[model samples]
Target chain A: MTVIRAALLGFGTVGQGVYEAIKTHQKRLQERLGKKVEIAGVLIRDLRKQRSLPKHILVTDNIEDILAIDDLDIIFEAIVGNEPCYTYLNQAIEKGCHIITANKAMFAQFGTKLLEKAKQHRVQVGFEATTAGGVPIIRTIEQLLQVNKIEKVEAILNGTSNFILSEMRKNKLSFPDALQLAQERGYAEADPTNDIEGIDAFYKLMILSELIYGGQPEWRTVEKQGIRTLTSEKVQLAEQKQKRYKQIASLTKKDGKVLASVKPILVNKAHPLYHVEDVDNAIKLETSLIGTFTLQGPGAGKLPTASAMVEDFIYVLEKDKSIKQQGEVVYS
Target chain B: MTVIRAALLGFGTVGQGVYEAIKTHQKRLQERLGKKVEIAGVLIRDLRKQRSLPKHILVTDNIEDILAIDDLDIIFEAIVGNEPCYTYLNQAIEKGCHIITANKAMFAQFGTKLLEKAKQHRVQVGFEATTAGGVPIIRTIEQLLQVNKIEKVEAILNGTSNFILSEMRKNKLSFPDALQLAQERGYAEADPTNDIEGIDAFYKLMILSELIYGGQPEWRTVEKQGIRTLTSEKVQLAEQKQKRYKQIASLTKKDGKVLASVKPILVNKAHPLYHVEDVDNAIKLETSLIGTFTLQGPGAGKLPTASAMVEDFIYVLEKDKSIKQQGEVVYS
Candidate 1:
């Protein structure tokens, strides 16, 4: 069987999930691609740590080890930081390998540059997991842009913040208590600074803005206010009036300038974003053609994020096949 | 400039909308495809009728006039019926021209046959507008199927029936009164048999079923019940219980069999379809990888349907370009 050799840049939650998904759905992947997807190497922080990977696959702490793999077809990067992930992806692209990443922070900062490098190298870059996990918002936006102009985009891009706000409103709990519950459920990190301080949503919003408008607002000028100071009383009062408080990341182009913001807004019942609660994320796009289009699903998770990457991998393979073959293509 | 010669099979609402969309987005289309889209011919029922088309375009009552167009790359079919539309599409496919259609009734019956013929002729058939007009459910499903198995699909596929049901509950109107209001608002046709009797939703459901499962229930075996018999009192009672009556078309795979139905189902507030009101349509897909993903939008409108067809046309062009070009491809 023809095998596409791939490497993983991190063995964290998303990386492990991607590996497991490839294992569990190997048959389906083979059936769709007509080729086997093999994980040739994995780059981890600690080589001493035990992993349940097959013995034939190489696990290393050095990025150079994975980059040295012969005929490496793709790279899946799930590292948390912005420095090495960006540099590593550039290196992979230089080696003519398609790359898929879940590193939102790194992507938000250097996504446009990375895309240009990938373009110049004639390799694909899949970042669907960088914005909204499992919702396919990136792909949806691309398809919508083919025939329609997106006038406005309002979205709940951070699952942790949305979950915290929803818990506060639904359980009438204080912000701290709701955040504690979120941590207990693994929705929020130990520090929770990035998620609760609106920085996470800001990154995702910038990613979306760049995709839709082909540019983004100046980072410091983009207003971002998180939900740490919102009181339980305010949430309850809003609920009494049939309104809900949600963390909304919005982008609108006016006067040929893209205005972007990430803040907590009280939404009415008629608003599509009002019902989007808990760990679920939703995006409402007001387009030039379709009046209002909404898509909602799990914003972030091991499987959902991994599923996005796997789907991107399959898409890259299929698109690559179309360029190589002259006969009928099932999807194209 | 390189040009793609095209034709419109019907000049009804959807057909006219497609023409208008092409004209309005001509610049963007040319920018994306690097090819000007030219409407070389149009097949209409009345040859002498006034059409708001350019003088350079040919409008005809006969199909042969359209088939004779030189270098025809695509055909956009929006005709209402099953027989002549199917035959015309088959003929177009035989000419090795790509086709996009919004004819749900015809597609629900002969979609598989048409797809097979298109495959044989190496022509693409796009039926994105056949299921949920602006929701892009068909394309969403196709993308999801790449890495996930769809376990269940529940959707509001008809706007007229949903409008009547929403009005009946919201205004306490009788079924006939609500339907009359829908007709006045141009949401329903004068002959409301297909919409009110659930046949329209059934056809769309069948189309979705065929897309997902590659087969559908025997037509007679599918249980379909419309909202015509739903009483205002019942709707009010359900509303009091925080529920809504929606014309739901649902499909589930169990024990390796695909069970399908279209009916007026009372949905609780927690149900995704509960908040879908008026002419809005929503589809909830329960997939193996993504859990429950929902998309909501305008179910039917001139601009929305036309937007879908135009998007499909762009997709076909992009895919075809990838097959022909050996160098870099933007979307692929």
Candidate 2:
């Protein structure tokens, strides 16, 4: 058994959760893998921020402090936005260090180039946490593509919007009231534009498109709509008709072209999406071999999202070791 | 690229689907895997029965014929029941052939022994299809165990029972009427004993337990209940309260001991599992790292079940090559 030293690229909620989960579930993780995993460094934007992180682990603002360290085997990028994340990941990949990123924005925008780079470097890049928190959608897609020709992927990829929509339908609350309630419950960020306006869902869908369908549809090609226009009356009307409104991000391939969109759709009571409510996310894949298969789980949160990152770290470690030994042999 | 010669142990629904999936998706599988996978032989119990099948493939009823084929790299056992499936799988393992099985009965009873045998033989056993059709629950559990501590797993593992319950709730039908309707719809078998009595869910739960927790709980130790005793009145009462009755198989570790059960439980509308309706199956796993993660999909059907078996076949092909090059060593 080899012990892999890991580094955190950001110390926000997800990063902190990763650290905490590693400490809390260390015994179980070790038992399962038959090895010890340790966090060697954390790259925070600010070094003086007061938090309950382990004092012994080094915290630094300089990326090179962590990146230049030869002992670090993998990097977990929980950093939001594109600039630093893209730079750090590219550098990490170039350094022959495996990567597990929770940064959907970077992947959504530059995933193709990054994946190509990783492949060129003969390293593994795990982005399971980027799409659906902890639902294992990436691995699921990888497995499904093996046995099925997936024609379409429809998902409620944004939890904040789903949470608000679910509350509006069940509690009969106005959109504003639901949004406010979501904020109070910490389900929605203060700005909430990314989630409520559907940008977050769009980003996730972009990643899914790349992973499942070979490449992403142009950002401009995706028809985007948010939950802001939805009224309480519309939700009630849908419910009266035994339906529910969901913020759906769907990508379909027709005539060798991929069409992607993020919009609010009315799901009848019979559909599985109708049952997906309140910060919960569900993905349905329509495939030639299996017909339709769906997976639902927490689309976002500190612990769940961190769990995904941890899973990605382990997967990357395992896959990276194999890639190192076998060289870059592309599988069919 | 090594071409893995594979054989089908049974030509049932899943076996046929595996055949068709391989034949139809040949180009795609080859493109992804970079290897040519060919079917060397197919084992069937009877050959006189009229069935749609390819002409060039060799078919035989004798297990000895399959076992004697030294060139066969893998055996996909789609046969149901314990007697022949178990015996053939053991033989295949002993003969250094990787096994991909869709039979849950054999796995539920003898997975540990078979897994140990496969380990000793340095071969792999793929059992992804034995759980929830094409939902990828087994792979998800494998990934979860890689990173997180799975504290509990609660699921509606049997689609036939779920379909019956959903029908009873939606149409206010009696249990018997719903069951009859299910039988008519081909969701329920004629006897429906295994599904309706919670035996099927129990078997699946055992498999999940083994995969996630590394061992199976005692079959008799799991507290069991079924939908057979669920009355329409109880269904109506639960619905009136905005709750749904779901046949849930819940597994948890308490006080360092495994606690498992399968029963019909009332789930509030807020719970993610509450929305899974009809014949669909949903699984919600609570882990220390990720709070609650749920996956839902077509639990059972000819194609979905077949899709799972095919996925396992592809996995065995991919992992076998990787494992052969590198030994079965865990990387941190």
Q: Which stretches of candidate 2 lie over 4 Å from their true place?
A: A1-3, A28-35, A51-56, A328-332, B51-55, B328-332
Docking class of 1: medium
Report the poorest 10 consecutive residues by lDDT, candidate 1 chain A: A323-332
- The residue-by-residue lDDT of candidate 1 on B206-249, one tens digit each, is 98888899899899999999787899999999989998988899
Model 1: residue B131 alpha-carbon error in angstroms: 1.1
Q: List the residue pairs that clash in candidate 1.
A: none
lDDT of 2 at A289: 66
True contact recovery of candidate 2: 0.74
User: Residue B292 in model 2: shift from native, Å?
Assistant: 1.7
